[model samples]
Target: MTITSSPWVHPEPSQSQLHLDVVPENVLHALAAGESASFVPRFVSPYLAGPECLSLWRMRSGQIVDTPTDAPWITRLMVDPRVTAPVGVAGFHGAPDDTGMVEVGYRVDPLLRRRGYARRSLETLLAVAQGHPDVRTVRASISPENTASRALVSSYGFVETGEQWDEEDGLEIIFEVSAG
Candidate 1:
């Protein structure tokens, strides 16, 4: 896969040489076995087991792909090479309804926080969503206390709609980025 430079609405420079590739199943198995340790904390949960992570990467050609089980969206996002990396992952309740309105989710490594990776990744994800005729909107659920997360998504045009109790996390503030 080849990474091409594209117009980025965010402040960061568009990465011209970065390509987003689908993670191979073997790599995912290795990660489940705890062979690789990069970006481990950035995963959700099932990924910890190594089967469901379905992780991808932003790399130049000839780079080996590592699988991280915690990031399932990597599978869907890989539907388009234009999606460089997955900033987040969401499951059943957080997934899109029948209307194709999916949720935007992410988890940055604690040490990697505040480095603009999330923003850049999110910008790419939003761009991919906008390009898809099926996606009408992208939603995100964040804890009110997660100031950094709130700021990140809000800066990208996600607006607060309300709050609700999530089975995984208690009360979360709902935000959405509409295609309109």
Candidate 2:
């Protein structure tokens, strides 16, 4: 949703608390390099180095090359404030398009799934989108086989508009809802 704001805020500490620590270029590089333990952001848990997260870092590190350092809002660790450790990753696909459409992506560690972290991550992204002036619509392109994710989006009032074939993720159901 083109969250132009800096220092993205996290929810206040509570049992359900989750925060995002922007994964900087160097950290992305190190994660992409497969050395999660030695990464610059020592507070980031190694769970963030999961295969999915590794791919995200590899791709995002390349994305920041010619872009503004703070512009992408690309990837952040979905952290558990109680222990200050990451349990997942969440961020927009990119800035909003001409139609004010922006897509959201989030992946919680497989081992840590079903603890409501995914829901919290989606809530955070939706809050960001709703507050951004440029965002009119938020999108979630989910794999049809992913019932949990499908249910998640639907519960947020997103309606399925159609479907698309993705080279990497195969067929996906596209859901959209007004950002506000």
Candidate 3:
């Protein structure tokens, strides 16, 4: 799938050369409506608005409705400029809470897995958290079966704190790291 080239938004560059462009609400609404073309032409993968990403667009749309300020924190498209296509998605669940903690989530296209996209996404989130005055902690709840995710977080000094049963994700092992 191809997407016409367009300028990337966020100026914060990453080691992976992946730009985590915040997915705008208009685009989210269009993708939720099953029309990827409803969005401005961006250098992104067709998968961003495909059926595979429907639930994400839908969920984030609803989230923006209730917490408009969380828009920027909630979702981003992980795009590789060299390829001018999205490799995956990433960002926090929402703004930092009262405890100064923000939960992170990301996913790489199955075909693009193990290419360091996920790592770059997590690193970006960590860097954001570290730099934001309101953020003091970064959290990730990964499934125990997802050893790769666990290892990734561990390499970054995240500590296993506990586990929880998620309605949609089943059991997940919780990990956290100081954003400082």
lDDT of 3 by residue, 49-85 (tens): 6677788888888998988878878778887777656
List, residue by residue over 84-109, the lDDT tens digit for candidate 2.
Answer: 46777888877778998889999887
lDDT of 1 at 154: 90
Cα lDDT of model 1 by residue, 42-107, tens digit: 232233324333232221011233323223334321112343333333221222357978776555
What's the count of clashing pairs in each model shown? 7, 0, 0
Task: Return whichever of 1 and 2 wins on lDDT.
Answer: 2
Q: What ranking of all candidate models by TM-score puts the best one first?
A: 3, 2, 1
Model 2 root mean square deviation, Cα atoms: 2.7
TM-score of 2: 0.86
Q: Which segments of candidate 1 are over 4 A away from where they belong?
A: 1-21, 29-96
As for candidate 1, its clashing pairs are 3-18, 47-69, 47-70, 53-69, 87-106, 88-105, 88-106
Higher-lDDT candidate among 2 and 3?
A: 3
Task: Give the TM-scores of the predictions, in the order they appear.
Answer: 0.58, 0.86, 0.86
lDDT of 3: 0.79
